[model samples]
Target: MLQGAGVVSLSGISTGAYATGIEPFRQVVTRYAIRPNPAAPWPAGLRLRIAVLTDIHACDPWMSLERIAGIVAATNALQADLVVLVGDFMVGQRYVTRIIPAAEWAPVLGGLAAPLGVHAVLGNHDWWEDPDALRRGGGPTASGTELTRNGIRVLSNEAVPLATRAGPVWLAGLEDQLALLPVRRRTGRGRLGLHDLAATLKAVPDGAPMILLAHEPDIFAQVPARVALTLSGHTHGGQVRLFGWSPVVPSRYPGRYAYGHVRERSDLVISGGLGLSIAPIRLGVPPEIVVVELGAEAVA
Candidate 1:
């Protein structure tokens, strides 16, 4: 009778482990609205829906190509006016048992659809592997040309005006902060210069509202108030939270900008992202696809 009890106890323990360590891999859509700030100028009746997918540390046993397909399919269903991929397309380091090249994931990512266009920016992980390689090569096997062929514009320290029924909105992307680090310490934290920010904003038309895509939320402090919204992902909502508190948040600000909407000088939204890093487990924070809807406030 004691032996039988031991077997049942072990089985229960196994089930609980799966629930805590693996089930959080299941992704969810977290939606938010970006209302026009009184300080920022927005065209009347401007309503733009943007879908953001970031930190897709594509590998095996967890973030497989099949899983990416599901994420793409769901984002397409949202029918967003603009779709932006915030970066970290490949794993930072080989912590997982299985690894998949970025090439295999490109075609799947190309499947993403948005009415206006699909845009992407590099993340720290992309820089960690090889900055030149990531810039010249879209994925592991595919070249940068391949991603462009797929109609995805990979922006780097550049801005483009997107024509909308409401008005022209400037979409700007900054170079990964990690890229500025020294050769041996590229992954370490760094800061963006005001000149770099100015260069990106130079192309913007006067009085046009801007949306910036940056991978790390730490840069939120430097963005000018003129920027209507800044979208970022890198903290992964601390990946593992206990009772809404995360013990390890990978940000200079720690728990402050760990996740969700943060209103600083500018509006910042940090996505929890779609894959895992360091450890292959998530306890409380699940993978997410962020949908942000932008509209003008009611004229009361």
Candidate 2:
């Protein structure tokens, strides 16, 4: 099936090999004109277009600075009212020709621009692998620091309000839900995340529409109706989807939170994301830049 989709070559499949080296590098732009949802009502006249970039496990050949710059340019071309980055701006794959430092990658992402500004939330990788953050016992990962220094706002269980033509809009960025896995993995301590959803929601006053940015899609299940739309990544759409199914998903619910848009209590759009992890392989699912248009009719 993947072969028919042009994800893997015939020779590659004939050898019984699975990894498609090219799929990891290829990217597609996914756009959506959101339909009205009864569960999460859209604020009257409050329209927003969001461009989401996530799971950018920035590194050497897999996700190079040049490639990031290209993504930045591509995202900017979308002319979104807001840009939300759903984290993991750190190296994920072990085998790399060379590690690309944040200093180099940060400037590339600095190129990303939107009218509302580029906002971000840290991912599990940003917390676990950062030496400075680990050494200090908390906070300000190198990638987050550099991205902020370059004019992007990094949020950790924080919310920011934006002024739109329709009315006031709030962006709630949740910290990585799996922030303490490294310590837990290394020494059996609790892996509780620093995220405080209730506290974060407090920042949003009653009746103000909010958009939630969570790196992991699992948090979507907990998202409330006050949030009109929730954006997430980190699943990578299973990274190797075939016939619309991913065999190895990291989430506890497996396929439920694997990818694309889902609406339960709150509407959630999970980006397939721009990078890879664990292995340098992508099969049927390619990397992507997601653009979501809320209140699409307003623009029309």
Candidate 3:
């Protein structure tokens, strides 16, 4: 029997190398054809092809500048209509040879091309890791400020409608649900959330199809039937998964939020994410570039 930390090593480090060294550096695009809840009814003929990259815990040895650039190039090659980043741009772990500053990674991500434009949201780590942001309990976080400075649109609990070839659709991005870490508050037991789903959805006009960008899948519980789909990444497939089952997910839903497509009151697709957090490792689940195709599979 595997003893001591051998099992942990096997599940985390042995594969962690790939999570850190190999797979994440590669552009492994996984495509999904969203099937709307018949009862909820997605707008007919409103197709959208979106490229999603999330949890890019950009560090030196794990996720270098060169790696991010390559991923950007690969995503551009997909020719997606819109590219959405689901947050956690800053480094997520402490096992790094060196820390890559936002200034270094932001410009590289600015190269991402999409007709509808590149949009982003903040993640829990983006707030938890930044002292000033954690103290202020809000932006301008490094990921938010730097990403915006580089010209990538960072959405904070706001929605915008984009004109697509299929039709016009509203795209909303929620503020990170766990945006504030209560490190300063002695009595608070959990992190605070800034996400306002109701206010954000208010921006969507009636009769318009909508897509929401959220950092954590747990928020799906609060998501209503109005949203055709919700995209998120944070659990990193529980940072190690086997046969579509992740044992240590970071959400209240645990196993239910493992990875892949979730069909509930609102449809949610949680990407395995591109980088690891807490450690430089990812097991059965490799990094991925999620390509979500809406409507009649408009993406060729």
Candidate 4:
């Protein structure tokens, strides 16, 4: 039996390192869509396929161009009307310039197309790699404006009205909580206040069914009562687990919210994410690209 509190040492670490440099690998992810049913008969017949992809951590080979391409292809096949990228789009510290480089795979992130439109928010990694630039400017100046040139819209603490068949679904994206942290610890730079929720909600009037795309699911507990659904994926489903238990997760949330599908009060669904965090190889927790079929009843 494996203890949940011991240090995990994988084979790759001996030959290489824990971070695993940067390489791309893909995993086809699946997830169930959840809704909050406050009253009788939540819209039963109406349905929508929402593709949720979180934690790309795209750093060239680490998160393969081929894999990202596969994700886009999968999303198209599912005919997902709405696509949500929760966060960790790119990763790198000093090599921020190379965070999202130009190569044959440069177009993967932006190739996604949905009738309801693709929605995304910045993750801790994205903010750490390149924050101010992805905000004021669309893309890095030196990179020849690649990400935006391809078509990915990075929303930071903002809201966009999505015209859905069922009236209008308001889509909101929050800035990285890691970005707002008090800068007191080893990883202090990425923390941010959860106040973005209130501001974004205020922007959307009353009675609009709103869906939020946040990199971290920690916000789920703090979201206003009216927000219908929230999608997140920063956990990476416990990237390398021994016998179904993950020893460590970087986030501050509870371990129950770490993997699979957890129904939190019927309004939250957090994907295990699609990429690796510190370790490139995954064990029990393979990467995923979630296809959530949203139905009338809340997923339980």
Look at candidate 1 and give me any clashing residue pairs. 103-140
lDDT tens digits by residue: candidate 3, 136-183: 667788888889999899999899888876577788999987776556
Q: What lDDT tens digits, residue by residue, belong to model 2 across residues 1-300? A: 866767557665743344546678898998776754655646676667899999999888889888998999899998999998999988888978777888888888888888899999999888878867765656878878998999999988889988887777888899888887777677777655778888888888877778889988887778788788889899989988889999998898786899887878767888889998988888887899999998765223
Give a tens-digit lDDT track for model 4, residues 180-259. 34332545444344336778777776776667777777777777666666788887766666676778766677576676
TM-score computed on alpha carbons, candidate 2? 0.91
Q: On residues 172-288, what C-alpha lDDT tens digit does candidate 1 reach at each position?
A: 987676643444344444343212567787767768889999988888888888888999998888987778788999888986788888877778999989887777767677899
TM-score of candidate 4 on Cα atoms, chains taken together = 0.77
Regarding lDDT, does 2 or 4 come out ahead?
2
> Please, what is the whole-model Cα lDDT of each candidate in the order they appear?
0.78, 0.84, 0.84, 0.64
Candidate 2 ranges with C-alpha deviation above 4 Å: 1-19, 39-41, 297-300
For candidate 3, give the lDDT of residue 245: 77
Please report how far candidate 3 places residue 244 from its true position, in Å. 2.0
What's the ranking of the predictions by lDDT, best on top?
3, 2, 1, 4
| Candidate 4 ranges beyond 4 A from true positions | 1-26, 33-35, 39-44, 92-106, 131-147, 180-195, 242-244, 296-300
Evaluate model 3: give its lDDT.
Answer: 0.84
Among all windows of ten consecutive residues in candidate 1, which has the lowest summed lDDT? 135-144
User: Which scores greater on TM-score, model 2 or model 3?
Assistant: 2
Error of 3 at 94 (Å): 0.7
Give the range of the ten consecutive residues with the poorest summed lDDT in model 4: 136-145
